[model samples]
Target: MASSSTLSRRSLLKVGGGLGLLAAASQITPAWATGKGTKVSVNSPEQLLSLSAVDLSQAIRGGSVSCSEVMTAYLDQIETYNPTYNAIVSLRDREQLMDEASRADTELQRGQYRGWMHGFPHAVKDLAATKGLKTSLGSPILKDWVPGHDAIFVERLREAGAIIIGKTNTPEFGLGSQTYNSVFGVTRNAYNPDLCAGGSSGGAAVAIATGMVPVADGSDMMGSLRNPAAYNNIIGFRPSQGLVPFGPTKEVFYQQLGYEGPMGRTVQDTAMLLSTMAGYDSRVPLSQKSNPTSFAGNLDTNTQGLKVAWLGDFNGYLATEPGVLDVCEQALKHFNTIGGTVEAVDMKYPMEEVWQTWLTLRHFLIAGIASGLYSKESNRALMKPEAIWEIEGGLELSAMDVYKASKARTSWYHALDKLFDTYDVVALPSAQLFPFSADTHWPKEINGRTMDTYHRWMEVVTPGTLSGCPVANVPAGFDSQGRPMGIQLIGRNKEDLKVLKIAHAYEQAAKLTQTNPTLVKS
Candidate 1:
């Protein structure tokens, strides 16, 4: 068993001096938050370290703390922790970041508040290109590749006054569930440095978990955002399809599965980040005209009479680890305290078909994006095996396969629509297992069941991705091993607001987010 300690409710609050910042900003209890029966305690730096992106925004905007203070605090924490965690990579341009922060402070002094993200120093996932910063996509071929312009999401973040500190690590081409590549190495869990921080948003999640960033930019296709958030004990949301639009793409309508979204330590902070991300542009046909501002507004915490369907194991079909299921089940009971009803719902579908559909569609998009890179000898040599497999799988897909997968995806959406007709939300374990060894590759099995592919272990999230439903991963608690665990709050198609509201209510009831992980320095 892993060595661990328990954090009392009083000590958890004392770490942050209060719970206001974490309460709404995607909050959770880190495994090491305990002050007694443990070797570690929350130190003074953690006080500022625990503030959510929303709290930091308010504090910086309101002049409670200078931008330089916020910038230096996170940079100090990152410098202290990143060497061990390997969450952020390609560090450079700090002098520029310091200058921008000072300018932001000057602007604030003149009563010019840009927005919620004003003057905040944060990093984008290496998968997202940023101008002048090294955006490696975790691939060796792009090791020194710097984009001349920001990706759409990065552009939006900058527009909202977010300072791009650097890029977070990711799997090569964002191809796997684990954060690793030939470039930067694997990113470890914030709770335990030896355990895996779920990826390809792994670096982004760890960065936010350890105060490297208050909020971050992460993209999700197959649980990239949600899985890492679950592992890191933070909040990750995969908004409804078309809610966040990208640019300079040739295939918008056909390939909309992969999307860039926000990551934060709190839902309110996540929502605030989403406000800058969500917008409609004719350049991307799939863009939704959602009022992103609504996401940042007051979250409804009252769960009076909300019906929740506890679909543990997808009707006993998913091979979830016993301990993980237990944690999720315990979290479901918290719904009752918030006036939410829980009932077992047997999803009457062959669960494996969802995985099949996702594999086909996901590979098709990947192959399309990786089209010409393989032709170059240097690039082919730099490509990771999983990435090559994905590209090949996409290329091997037949027209019939595409047609069948598209039909299956449509059917899956209808099936979820039917399920939502009966219940407001469906709850399940975010990841099948808690954080595993960061030193190892993907788990080959779950509960003794062998996984067939490198990504098969992450099949649990495929349905949500396939259905295009809005899903949020909220921290449930921790496994006996002191690793993080979380529950997924899934809403109906495009019911993004309702999804967040239910997650907020559960967050309030669970009170897990109130605790944060204290780095157990060796």
Candidate 2:
């Protein structure tokens, strides 16, 4: 005779079909997650929610805390704060989640241990499929669509013992950095409810910032992860291209512009999540075959006499709002205190050429994926103007145009590669301006400069994105209006760990994550 908990566990296994299969196939056995490391006991939900993800993991694994209690604290936090931020959508039922948590505890008691994320509550970005959960991508056309399968990263997260709570908000088809759409409305900045949360990872960053989730997975095509992290004052890491297996999608090679990464309140948490999300999958031929566990190891590294190239406004080629550069410069000073020299380096590469290359490639890739939606008049009517513009721009491009863009992109890469010969990491502002009003669509101009395109204001992020290198957005502190900003620490290609090391050291020196968001505090 089977016990009720045993029956419930079996039912969960059936419900998580592919997830359960993946979990069994790749049982994550990291020493950091399962060790009887820290006996972290918490008396109240506040204390439990306050502990870092790493600490919480150890506490749950060591039996100092139960998964039900952790789930309860997170659920309470979400119930209280989610309404205001709109960071999480398609939220799961509380009773069902509690039952899952109870089953997780039962498994622990029976000595059937899972991985690091064992019993952790997690939410996938709206752009990624969440099996049973609706992945609206912030579009009303697909608002009711439920994915039957999870994205590769989501599958890995499930395999690592994460309970899928729901989906985070993103822009329509993740076309913009602002996280508002016809489906979920706007995802407010974690620091200020009235301001826009940068997207398409806006909801993911906000969820982490507000303690709604310990960590989150996000994709960055054009500063999606970095910009939102900057807005919310959290760590958003864009790993080296191909470092993380993204999809088993139809178009694999052409979709090189975007890559999924992790966001967290701290660098270690970001690194830990990255470790789980990375590694090769035969389905995704471009995925790296490196050991993912390497990222989960010690991040503390000596930064004595390290050379950092500060690409401020690309020598005034970029139009930045007032104080954006000053804040980033001040944040770079932390590297100096840590024995790393931050030198302002003028990029000799043609700035306009790089922007043109980005526009061409972005338009081509977006159009390739979205042409189906654009073909339908009813769907086109429901789509955002930015989506339509990208499709149309791509439709207008010739083979020669794409070839020229690719050539220019290669040239820009070589230029950045040349700088890497002298500098260990290249630094730039993660965004052009601080968080703007959630009511506004996109910035029309910056400092009296006319923006030609909807995403022109975000041109500052193109250099890092185009380099195909590892980039981490570290908090650059707040402006006069208390709006947050961040600076991008871009490292040489295939040096994801190096970037994380520098970010961790700078984080220790700056100690910006010590400040919680106003929403969370209240």
Candidate 3:
């Protein structure tokens, strides 16, 4: 087992005190509670819920707000809106959360502030283990599993004074992009209600979008964070792999493709959350020790002179929606306005080969972790068909296959490195299409092109995933049907802050973050 205690004093202080303190101190007043002491804006639940973490923090710090008030507001919204979305699978102890808020207020009175998240309520994805909370990961096999310990990220968030209010839904074992399982039914998009929230972090995005939580933590492997963020018109950031730790557990496959990241309604809040979440973890072999810099710091830097390469389409592998590309092109013009130059570039790598390689590696890892489920009579019926297929695929892979996949990944990384040599950032459409119908697993056709596999339609993310680059989904604009669209900004490895800076600049320039989803209470 990896040792949590192995974290250096520098890392501990960074996680426990540094950027976290700054984050805690910065709060934005809830839009609903401006000037008037009462008259809460339940009228615009979606707009109220849309307030970013930074906005909430600013609100709390202005002395016009209390932690309990924010918590109650969100809880009320959840009650009103989550029934249709089925986003929040399990809620935290409400009374305890209120108590924590009261204590935060007390601390403020004594001038002992916990930080930006001190009184803010947040939710963790069901896939994450939260101590004393039932973390089902949307699977029946773990229905009764209550972890005795919090995942490292969860503990870190708690220590930063974030209120743990609930667990959002996920697919069983996070095997699929759609957020539905026998355990939690289905998580729907907050914008359309009829569309599915892109999964496995679907519920987290929905929670943020629907006002259930101001911000939430989500894990991404195959577009879980980005897809959902795009679907819901929010911010989802996937930091470079190993920037956040993966374990003190036996799950090595998850350690590779899977990553715990932050999802929020705004980029600054996502940056603040990442500042709190990123740090050295002795328990996770891949976790990296970050420099003592706030993720939100240096965001004021101008994008002028920043070199960006735009991959408008991935060599025709995936079809692009016209509106999605239109918004992305408009966003690119902002880079030029700020003095940054944009160029069209071809990735030149064989995406089909890379897709197959990723599947082979993914199968091996998922199967290895789920090997025990292969038995015929160990209540193995609890597993989903997708999970079983992935596991069996992994079981069939040879050592040579794994070796070849790794080599291919190396080649792909080299190709990306060459591209980054000329560009500070890479821009792409976050998704090939806007939010599709919730009932369908994947769209049969998009932009007149038929997709053979549910996951194949989302191949645009492979470049970032395979390269382990820092990628963020920034809300671009809405499509014709009012569904949100996003543009992804990918930065060089370890330059997550740079990507965030660019995203923040664009967010401010576009002012898209100011828009809220149209909420319909069920």
Candidate 4:
């Protein structure tokens, strides 16, 4: 817990206060609530921390576990493990969080329930604007900056009665896949402290995997949600572009590449959080008008004849490291076991052209977002080379260049559409390689091919991102070195529930989420 206001006697006071408050509240337990009979049997901090987000939410709502106990359990868990892994940054003071938890308990006693996540302690990704909390996008330039208002998604989280405890770490300006920045150092992998935690959702995924937070909000432009979930052995869902209203920012319409999504240890928790985060907001012009609460509905579905197209390595166009494909292929077999047919599909469109289109649109967006900082010599000195490269690439493009890139993007979308016409979902490896060295920024080579750009190693994620479809990263089993990996299940546009249902069914069949890292216990 990195806090400026670390009180010497705070932990003892919090524990005593939480117990006193919970005991007093227990005397007046409501008849409608489950009281002490909830299915979750939490006898210790480890037991409480081990409960899934959905289970914890149910326990809190049923009056089985008071909010203060939940808060204290998480705070202690964070104190025990966060220093070693660096999964969470800019954490609020423990005493203040405990106070908020007590208030939540009082509200429940008065029958003022908020939502599914009522009283759940949550940490927003550092990229999103969290009112009154530090929104340092892991950059030293605005390290002390705090927003006065919340981002639209943050507003949703607060409205659902979640107590904002802290901000999860992210790459500076979310420019790269690996989560490291000059401001807060690096976030280590959940499975292994020495390996890289993929980002810019790296901290959020690690927090969920390590039980520091129940569920977290993360944004994805190029596999920010999927890659980290794959690396951490968790579930990350990237919903369709406009399903979650992104900004309530200056640039909303043109900047459609990046999207806000949910990541959790289970598919149900991810879908539940998505229900809270998504919906139509009049503030965002491009926001979809569908019912977001429907995502929280029952995920059970019959995939008896579902058609899945395995676009493995894009017919060998992508250069993957040794064992990634094998692990994902093994995971794909679970779909077959669940009565879905899997077939290897060849690419109808040229992959290189798709890559080129991604580069152009990404550069254009990055330049538009970061050009002001790039214009200043002092700021350029503080930025990473990859950020500079993106800005420069965007600066060099002309109107005609952007127009042509948009046309290419449309063609790629059509190509994906054609696939969806035949198959229910398209599958790919979430990452090209397993967890790599955290000291090294990004992989220079995969197998023998050199990566041309900082993000080219993660080009496998772009098709789902480019098509504005719903993509969920489901846990594929670990590699020989105990390094975890995941596979992406891409559904047709706006078919978020279909993707989640298949992911839940696949998760049940795979049984990989049952495995926990050693650090989670320690």
Best by the TM-score measure: 2
For 85-144, candidate 3 gives per-residue lDDT tens digits of: 999978867788789888888887787766667788878899998888898878888888
Name the 10 consecutive residues with the lowest summed lDDT in model 1. 9-18
lDDT for predicted candidate 3 compared with the true structure:
0.76
lDDT scores in order: 0.79, 0.86, 0.76, 0.86
Question: Candidate 2: misplaced stretches above 4 Å?
Answer: 1-34, 520-522
lDDT of each residue in 1-522, candidate 2, tens digit only? 101111221121111111110011123445554456757788889998888888889889988889999999999999999989999999999999999999999999999877889999999999998788888878888999998999999999988889999989999999888999888788999989999999889999999999999899999999998999999999999999899977878887768889899999999899999999999999888888888887777777767767787777876899999899888877876776777766667666779989999999999998898899789999999988889999999999999999999889888888888888887888889999889999989999999999999999999889888888999999999998999999899999999988898898889889999889767433
Could you give the candidate ranking by TM-score, starting with the highest? 2, 4, 1, 3
Which is superior by lDDT, 1 or 4? 4
Please estimate how well model 1 matches the true structure, expressed as its whole-model Cα lDDT.
0.79
Runs of candidate 3 with Cα error greater than 4 angstroms are 1-51, 251-254, 376-379, 447-450
* Steric collisions counted per model: 9, 1, 16, 0
Cα lDDT of model 1 by residue, 1-522, tens digit? 111122221121111111221223233322211101122222345666676666666566555678888888888888888988999998767787789889989988897766678888878888877888887888888888988887787888888888888889999888878898878778888999989999889999999888888888899998998999999988999988888886556677787788988888888778778888998878887789878777766775445567777666765688788788777777776776666667666667777888888889988998888878976778877787788888889989999999999999998888777877777887777888878888878888988999889988888888888888899999989877888988888899778877887787777778888878878543
TM for every model, in the order presented, reads 0.90, 0.93, 0.87, 0.92
- Which portions of model 1 miss their true places by more than 4 Å? 1-46
lDDT of 2: 0.86
Worst 10 residues of 3 by lDDT: 12-21
